[model samples]
Structures are given as structure tokens and as C-alpha cells.
Target: MLISTSKSLFSSLIISTRNTSNLFIGKNVRLRNYHNKFPLAGIKVTVLKEPFNSQLIPKLFENFGAEITIFCDTSNIKKQSIDLNLTNSDFVKAEVFGTKVTPKKYIEAGEREIDLSVDGDLNVLKKYAIKSDIFINLENKRFGEIGFNPEEIIKLNPKLIFANISNFNQTNSKFVFVKENMNEEYLELLHQNSKTLFTLGEISCFTKILLTLFNKQNSGKGQILNLSISDSLLHLNRLTSPLLLSIPNAFDRFYLTKDKKVFSLCLPTINDQQKFLKNLNLTNSKEMSAKIAEFDLSELNMFLKGSLCVCIC
Candidate 1:
């Protein structure tokens, strides 16, 4: 997710820019939270393309809101199109990896997928993006020039990458990208917030742009490698304006102890949480949970819910 401060518009824009919105798969915590926050309230939401999340929209009024409205993606208004922002566009050849490598093959060597499409080509994608007060980019596919013109795509990435961040970076906003894979607690927070927001795929060069956009001066400017909260912030001078602190999380951790679904789709319990913890040597390092302290992996939810907001540096 991107958190950008627009000095011109004068607003703190925090947004999620990924397709995880589909993860709701008939359930939306945002809607759930909205109901809890303001019962029978009418809030405006704009979704692009897929009508998956509409599951929650149909029955919203039964519980709250004087009127349920759709301002974008009106195709599913009957189901739950609160806001509509449809646009005209043409289909572009899907760039699976910004390279010649397909996702499945890339992962065989332990990699991630990223693809891209151009504005006129990705017209549908671009159209949906600009419509939002805060555009969200669901890394549907990262397109890049794998062979001859990679920069063609790389250049496209920083610009086409939609989010409140782009709005700010387009204007040059100060921000931070924290890195510390050893961290699981705050890491989850970053993941939870940004999983649907910012995407770097697997390539670090593209990632550099992703990072620099927070605030950069070309030539690897505003980019920090091997992210660590303390070290990254240390390099950043005090900012006169609000800063967008972004942490990358989605899947670097494999431990699953607290997750209600320890085994998705009947998959065997892959890693023993306790053994995983013990292996981490966190007991000797800074930690919070005794479960984690004891060196045992646990449910993702358990590890998360028992998560300590304060880190045990």
C-alpha cells in the first residue's frame, strides 16, 4: 500500500494497490470494519474490472446505509457497484515477466511473477487507475522488456504504477522502505497493509525504482538496500513534511502456526512452527512472543494476533 502526502491537494493519501481485494472472495474486512465503524452508513467504493468483491455489496443495506450506491464498475451495480469509473481501452499482449520467462518457470528457480501493459494497450487497467481519488494497482501482471527494451517497461513501471504514492512521487514525496526479513510482527503489518498496494515482483532493479519513487534523485537516489527500520530511518534526515513509511510484506515468511488454515486445501503441515522458531535463534535475539521466543512456529494468525506492536529490538 502507498501512503503519500499530496501537498497541492493537501491530503494524506493511504491506499492499497493490489488485486488482493479479490482475496475477500465473498468476504471483506473493510466492509466488516465499515459496518462496525458506522452502521447503516453509506460509503463510496470504486472497483475495477473483476466483480468478485461485490459479494459483500449486495446485502450491505440489509444491515446499514440508507442507500447502497456504485460509482464505478457499474456492470455489477445490481450486485454491489458502489462507485463506477468505467473507461475505454484496448487489450495489450500480457507481459508475464517483463521478460521471456513465464511465471511457472521463473518460480522453478525460486522467483516471482511481474507483467505489464501500456496505457492505450492496458487502457482498461489505466482507465480504472486514474479514476480513484487514490489509485490502487493490483499487480495483475508486471510487463517489462525482457530482451531488447527492458527499460521500455522499467520506465513504464514507475510511471504506470498506480497508488497514492504515484500521486505523491509524481510530485516528489519523502518516504521510507524498511527491510528486515528476520522481523515477523511489524513485517506482517507492512504486508497486511501493502500486500495489495505496492509490488516489486522479484527483480531488484525494478524494485529500486519502486523504492526510489518514495523519493529519489535518479542514480539509486532515495533507495535503500537490505531494508532495516533503524538503519533506513537513520539515513533519512528529519522531514519537515509527513513521510510515507512503506514496508514490503506478502510472502517472505513461510512459518504458519497461528493461521486458522494451517493446511490450505488439505495441504500437509509443511513446517513445524515450534521447530521453525527454535531454528531462528530468536530466543537469543530480540523477540516478543514466548511461543516465538521458545523457537517454535505457530499459526500465522497466532503469530500475528499475539503480535507485539512494539518490537523487541
Candidate 2:
């Protein structure tokens, strides 16, 4: 099966177990990760470079033993932040074979700014999209009659794992939304603190795709995972939002110590506040920052025992 995380390297050991010998079709070595626990091991994986997010796939799936082939214009490879010679070494740490495609895409756009929305020919890119089991579409443009079409690519490769990453939200049947898992009152409080009353989009979408990949690998099904940037951030709000709402005035309750360390004190009730003072010799909210900064995490944990206060810094 497809074990997505670094923690579970052998839940279904796709690389060493699966019979995917026919999938290794190319020979040009481009990007490589050499981790002992390769998740996408034995599968010939192709990454489309251009979209900013496509650049992240190799690192994300590095330990999963997939022979990763980056399909991009050769110049794009040079544009990466890391030195060219060190690229192979980085992949080796992740435990996978990495390579790139030849007869590159953008030629005239060299050193000149090229908009991914209109840079390469859609027809040619489509062929590369379904070339492997998993296709990472970071094409920073909309998909349609004139753009990168998702539906069309699936038709070309029915078993392809297609992931479209862009700035905003996109919809598809395979995409799943994570539950916020918070009380109604807590959500309302968090909504007031945020601009659009939504979670950070990038974090949420990333988590959703990870969960989807895990499920798909276990089932051997091609899936489409869609996540909105805003909604995803909201999912994470469940951790800190409730604590902030428990206090009298959350925004004001946040304090900065003399040493420039920031922390929050959320006391749900007067008894809890009294207990906090009795247990830690902390009288007023003003003394909290300095007192907390003086103590280590273990000391703080002890003070928080049998207490309703949420100490977050």
C-alpha cells in the first residue's frame, strides 16, 4: 500500500513489495532521494516542474523509494535555489532516484519572465502529465479548454494520481475537507480573530492531500484531493482558538516578557485564576510573562496541572 508519512515505512512497503517493473520507462537521471524507507519505491514517478508546488514533491516523497523523473524545461532545474551538484545528495538522503526530461519546454522565455499560465504548450504538457502513476500539476493556471485540463489528463491515464496545486481553491470529487472539530462558540471566537474567518490555505490543503495519498495507496485507487487554503487553516485553529476564547479578553491576555518572549494566559474562570496564582506565586496577569519566561517547559507543565489555564507561547 501507499504509506505516506515518514513514520510508517513498511505498512505495505510499495517499493519492495509491488510488482511495477513495467513502470520504469526512462533512463535520464534527474532528482534522487536515497532514504532506506522509500514510500513510492519501485514506481516510476514523474514530476512536472514549473508550478511552484511541483518543486516540493521530491522532498515530500523522497523517502518513499520512487524513481522520480522531473519533467521540466532544463533551465527550470538550474533555477532551483540549491546548488546543482548538491541536488543528488539531497535526494539521496530521502532515498530515491531523481532525474529530468530532455528536449526541454520553454526556449525563448530564457532569463525573461514567463507566466506559467501561458508558458508551455498545453498539448505537449498533457502527454507528460499522465506519463507516470502520480502527476504533480503545479501549473499556476486554470484548467480548461485553453489551460491545463484535469479531466482530460485522467482520460489519458486512468490510474494516474493527479494533484493540482495553485494559489486558490479548486473542486473535484476525490478531494476531501478536514473537519474543524471545535465547539460552535470557539469557532465564532476564532472567526473574529481572522480576516476571512478561514484557516491558512496552504497548510490545510497540504494536510488534506497527505491524508488522501495515504487512503489511495492503501486502496490502489486513483484519487483527486482538493483543499482550500482558508478552510485548511481553520482546521488547525481547533488547537489554539478554544484556549484564547476561555480568557476574559484574549487579545489583551497575550503578553510579551522583558526578554521579548511572547506567551498567552487563558484562564476560563475566577477559581482557575486563583489556583494559578496560589500554585505558581503569580498574582496578576502582568507578572505572567516574566514568571513563565523564567521557568522551563517542565516547570510550566507542573504549574498547569489540575488547572484550566492554557499556557501557549
Q: Which number leads on lDDT?
A: 2
Tens-place lDDT per residue, model 2, 130-215, is 76666654433334523566776778766667765553424321112112212112223332223132323443454455556556
TM-scores of all models? 0.23, 0.43
Query: How do the residues 169-248 of candidate 1 rate in per-residue lDDT, one tens digit apiece?
Result: 11121221221111112223333323222222112222232343334212322211222222222223122112212211
Worst 10 residues of 1 by lDDT: 88-97
RMSD for all candidates, in order, please. Answer: 18.6, 14.2
In model 2, the runs with Cα more than 4 Å from the true position are: 1-10, 13-36, 44-57, 69-120, 169-207, 239-313
lDDT for residue 254 in candidate 2, whole number 0-100 = 33
